[model samples]
Structures are given as structure tokens and as C-alpha cells.
Target chain A: MKKTKKVRQEELKKTIEDSPFITDEELAKRFGVSIQTIRLDRMEMSIPELRERIKSVATQEWNETVKALPIEEVIGEVVDLELDERAISILDIKPEHVFSRNNIARGHHLFAQANSLAVAVINDELALTARSSIQFSRQVKLGERVVAKAAVKGEDERGQTIVQVQSFVENEEVFSGTFHMYRSNQ
Target chain B: MKKTKKVRQEELKKTIEDSPFITDEELAKRFGVSIQTIRLDRMEMSIPELRERIKSVATQEWNETVKALPIEEVIGEVVDLELDERAISILDIKPEHVFSRNNIARGHHLFAQANSLAVAVINDELALTARSSIQFSRQVKLGERVVAKAAVKGEDERGQTIVQVQSFVENEEVFSGTFHMYRSNQ
Candidate 1:
């Protein structure tokens, strides 16, 4: 049976809220409606396009984990963070991040993902790196999504914190780093 | 006495070649000519605008330091590089690099600049960061220009190469890092 317009719109809104990155085409396919209908429904509901939704989510969720620095300063999107414990961020490599000659991602992009996560996990208001050791296990290509996880190991005698960050693409480790951090109190 | 158009144009070309980041306003002031005249001379000489010129120089100079990894992977424009010795890069913080509310640059951008410079200074094609220690000395604002310098310290007993990278904004140190790099041979 064909659902009513109100019911369909409500469902569409729910779907988008659940998965902000879903495309209109995917929504249409899922709803058994045309792409135009999906777009119209989105417009009627005052919902933004996928890109705008992603940006909004990025900004809205940013304040939760970041205290020492603004959310925008984190290299990637911080999806989860527990200060002085653990944190996670996701970086989507775009065309601008790759070499035109080869669709490979720049190594710094990976490093940024891990480095920023390390900084975001610190509990203090001022967190900085005193030293770090990193390894790139593999080359990350363009369009790949790198998920970096940072875990706070412990504190040294000097009160500097140690954080371990590992970045993975499709569950494959691409980069890993151990950072010794300095805080204001420390 | 004022110089001829031909002589002035020749000198303008030399000045830009020496310092690619000079602005049109600065160029006009230096040449005692109108900005329009400087633009016209640049057009006639097929010289690009400041941004394009910077990008061009970055791509051209990138190959000089980067061999193992592609030049596109470097975060900032590599102005100078001496493999396994010293290197320098410049990063201009853009709007996208900062949080929307505050124009302060994200921490990752600084890290990327320093980390990439560290990677580029490695002589080997398969150089990777085995460990790193970094510090954010000050908060970097958007539109600020960061100049990062990387110098090789020495090698450890484990054969890991050490590189020190320091980033400055207007002669003020903003970020610094020490990287332990691993090459394929070592």
C-alpha cells in the first residue's frame, strides 16, 4: 500500500536523522520513490542536502570532546572522545587531498588525523606534544576513510601524559603514533 | 629618473621570481607604478596571480625534496628542502582550516605542516615516522602564515633517523615536533 505523504515525510526525516550521510538517490531507492520526490520531501521538511547535513553534524558534535582547543581544530571529525582516556576521529580523504597524477592520499593527512586525536583526548585546557613516534603501515589512497583511535596510556614521572594513536582504513592499520603530551598543570 | 616600461617590466619579473609571495600592492609600491600597471605587466609576461604562483612554485619545488612519497602528500608548499639534512615549508591557514565561530586554526593543520616537513627531509623513498613528539606553543589564527623548518639531528642506535621540525608564525614559534623516522634500509 502507498503510504500517505505525511507518513512518508516523517519516515524520510527519521531515516536522514539516523544516517546523515545517506544520499537522495539512496533514500529514493529505499523509499520506492523518485529522486525528485525525495528532494521535494527534503525541501518541504526544511532539511538540507547531504553536504550541509554532514557539515552541521560536524559542527554540532564538535563541542562534546574538545575542551583544550576548539572543535574545528581537531584534524578529523571527533565521533567519540573520553578525556584522558580514549578518543576516535574519522577523516574522509577528498580529491583535493590526493595527487592528480596518482589517487593516493598525502601522508600528512593521515598524520593529521592521528595527531589531532591525540591532542583532543587530553583532559587539560592546554595540551601539547612533547614528542611522538609514528609508523605508516600502508599507503592510503584517495576516497579512503581513515578512522583514528587514541588511547591515553598513562603519565610519566614528569607529569607528561602518553597517548597512543592508531589510524586505520577499512580496519587496516595505515598509521600509528605514540605521543608524549605536556599539559598546563604538568 | 623613472625607468622605461621594458626595463621596469624586466625588473618586476625578477622581483616576483625571487619572492613569489609578494602582493600586487607591494609590487606596485616597489615599482612606483599603479597596481593596474603591475597587473598588466604580469599579464603580458604570462605570470599567474599570487596564489597560482605559490601553487606552481610548490609543485615545482616539491620534487626536489620528496622522492619516496609523492610531492602532493606534503601539507604545505615546500620552499626549500635538503634531503636528510634540512627542509622548509609554508602553510597559509584558510577559512576551512579553522572553526566557524573563531578564526583560530585547528591543531592538526600545524601538525600536518611539521609532520610532512619531517617526512620530506628523509633521504629514503620509504621513510616513515616511527615516533614523534610535538608541542603547540601558541594558538594559530586563521589567515596566518606558518613557516616550518625541519632539520636532521642524528641517528639513534636502532638506526632510526631523527628530524626536528619547528613552525613559526611571523617569527613566533607556534608548533614544534621531533620525529623518529624509519627507512626501509634502516
Candidate 2:
């Protein structure tokens, strides 16, 4: 038997909420309804399209995982993060991130990428950096992608947890830092 | 005697370049022209208004002082910087920088402010961080203005320059860091 419109729309809402990246065509097939009906149902329900929905869900998930800070504050797009273990992020250098005179990437941008990844890898309610030792091994240019990796390196006698961060442009190391973090137990 | 239109416009451009924050009304008074005429001249020259002009000049000056990196890469607006000496920047956390559920400022934003400031204080064509020790003293809230100060602490025997950075929110210290930098003279 065909489902009623109200019941179908409710199921549609639940499906989209569960998998926000599902396309309209896929939804139409799943619901045994026309693409127009799916679009109409979405419009009536005030649900955005797949792209917007995916972005919203991704942002929310990122916020949840990043207990120490807001995800938007991260210098780069974090692709993976395992609390108290390892994390990875990627930064794409744009024209604005290069010196107009030299077309070279700024040193601080690399540091921001590494430092933020270091902070993000910690599993704590509040993680604070107490100290770091860092080095820039190479110069990065505009239009390059810098990948940053961060790993937790255990704690010290003073109860300070250490995180190591390294950034690379392609296969070459660009920057690295070791951050000592203070975590607040809640 | 009144100046020619061409000469007057040229003078106006020069004056604005010298003081980007000057108002159109001030320009009119100085040039003995109506505010409308000043606006027209600015329009013809494709010069933006006072606010845009100030932002442009400030960004350009900040870029020039930061030889090791691009100004756009800085996490905040760097208002002042002296090579191998001291630098200052301001970051105004926005709604997007906080978690939607809670309006707390992200930790990475604070780290970016301090880390970038540390790199900006170095006097070199190419500078990179080797290590750093950082601390977050307090939680920063949304819409807060973070002011970061960076000072050079001289170089070690191995030619690594040390920079110290402290970030404050309304005079309360929120974050602090020490950076070791490597400079390439060539």
C-alpha cells in the first residue's frame, strides 16, 4: 500500500536527518515518489538541499568532537582527529596567504596549522598549551596544500601532556612543533 | 588661487594615501572643495571610502613588516610590528568562531593569535618556528577582543631567535607562548 503524504514526509525527514548527504534522486527512489514530490516535501519542511544539509551536519559533528575548542577556530579543515592520539588537517594557501611581492607563504600560517592540530588532538574538557619547541624546515608557496599531523606524546611529571605537530607541503616538511598542554578535568 | 581639477585630484589622492583614515569632510575642508566634489574625485579615482582605505593601508603596512610570511595568513589584524623587537595584533571573535550550543571562544583561535604574533616579531626574509611552549590561562568567550603582544627575546648560540607572546582579553591574560625561530639570511 502507498503511504500517506504526512507519513511519507515524516519518514523523509528522518532519512535526511540520518544521512544528510543523500541526494534528491536517491531520496526519490527510496520513497517511491517523484523527484518533484521529494523537492516539494523538502521545501515545505524548510529542509535545505543536500549540500547545505551536509555542511550543517559536518559542522555540528566537528563541534561535538572538538571539546577543547570550537571547530571553526581551527586554522585548517581537520580531516581526522582521534582524541589523545592523533589528528590531521589540511590548509590550502590562497593568493591572500602569499606575499604579493614574493608569492611565498607566511611562516605564521604554517605555525597556525600545526599548533591548532596539536591542540585538537588532546582529549580533555579544556586543553591549554604550556610550551612548545618548533622549527620551519622549508618555505611554502601560494596555491600549495599543507597537511598537518598531530600526535599525543604522553604526559610529564608535572602532569603536562605533550603533543607533537608537523606540517608538510607535498612530501617536504615545512614546519614542526611540540606543545605542552595543561588539561582541566571536569 | 584655486588649483586645477587634475592637480586638485592628484593632491587629494596623495593626502588620502598619507592618512587613509581621514574623512571626506576633512578632505573637503583641506582642499577648499565641497564634500560632494571630494566624493566625486574619490569615485573617479576608484578610491574606496575612509573605512576601506584604512583597512587597505593597514593590511599593506602589516604585509610589508612581515617579511617571513604573508599578512593575510595572520589570524588577526596586526596593528603594529617591529622586526626583531615587538608586535601587536587584535582578534575579534565572531559568532562563527564559537560552538552554536555554547558561545565559548575556540582554543585554536587563541593559539593562532599568539603563534602568528610570535612569527611576526622575527626580523628575517625567511623565518620558521622550531619549538614553542604555550599556556592558556582562561577561557575566552564569544565576541571578545583578543589582543596579542609578541616580543623578541634575542637569539641563542645556535642562531635560533626566541619570541615571547602573550594574549589578553580586556587586560586579563588568556594565552601565552614562547617560540624558537630559525632565520635564513639568504
The per-prediction i-RMS, to one decimal, reads 3.8, 3.9
- DockQ of candidate 2 against the true complex: 0.23
lDDT of 1 at A36: 100
Off by over 4 Å in 1: A1-85, A91-105, A118-145, A152-164, A168-174, A178-186, B1-65, B69-72, B184-186
- After TM-score superposition, the amount by which residue A75's alpha carbon in candidate 1 deviates from its true location, in angstroms, is 4.5
Q: Please give the clash total of every predicted structure, in order.
A: 13, 19
Q: Write the per-residue lDDT of candidate 2 for residues A21-140, one digit (tens) a residue.
A: 567877899999999999999999999985455345432244338667668767898876778877778788997666565777766567678877777777775665666666777778
Which residues of candidate 2, in runs, are more than 4 Å off? A1-81, A124-130, A158-160, A184-186, B1-83, B96-102, B115-131, B182-186
Residue-by-residue lDDT tens digits, candidate 2, B118-139: 7677777666666666677777
Write the residue-wise lDDT of candidate 1 on A60-104 in tens digits.
Answer: 344455767777878788777778888878788999776454566
Q: Scoring each candidate complex against the real one, what DockQ results?
A: 0.22, 0.23
